[model samples]
Target: MHIRVYNTTNAFTSLGATFDERVLLGRGPTSSTIHGELRHRVGSLLPQQGNDASYAQLYIYDPASALEVRNCRNQQLRRDVLQTIQDTLLQVNPFVEKFR
Candidate 1:
């Protein structure tokens, strides 16, 4: 399972980074609470902004190696992770391109 969100807001990217760190540091509201023992990656595709681009792409996914050991528990965890990501997106309201 994977997601590629374009034009993501800085808040969303920052939250993702924080979540990953919390998962590592065992502090704060880590998404791992909903999905235990699952390997996932969620971060900005471009850490550095370009000359004219203010937004970035957010990538979220479980690595292929992790997928090899997939089971019912893993499937449920993936679903929960997706739900969490969707909720964050709804709050941040990113990926909305404006047209003039």
Candidate 2:
């Protein structure tokens, strides 16, 4: 007799999605702000390389409700959002390599 075991408990979970600002707003002033803010926020989330262009809109959809935070005017709120995301990610093991 042969048997196999598959572990499905720890699976990669995607937090959300982001799209370049230009894709939505073309060429505009907000694009610049989005780029700068995205760099700051995402940079903290992951290692940043170079200064090309990371301008994007953040959309987080999970745990029932969805959240969308734009602009860097409210530094505190942006920080809070980033912290929340980081905390959540820490709590969940999104990347799992073993299936046994």
lDDT per residue for candidate 1 within 1-100, as digits (tens), equals 2332312222223332222334556555535433334433444454455422222332222222222332222343454454554456545554522110
lDDT: worst 10-residue window of model 1:
58-67
What TM-score fits each model?
A: 0.21, 0.22
Best by TM-score: 2
lDDT of 2 by residue, 1-100 (tens): 1111001111122223355555556654543223222322333322257522221212222322222221233233444444455346446543311210
User: Cα miss at 39, model 1 (Å)?
Assistant: 28
> How does each model score on lDDT?
0.34, 0.30
Model 1 earns a TM-score of 0.21
Clashes of each: 0, 0
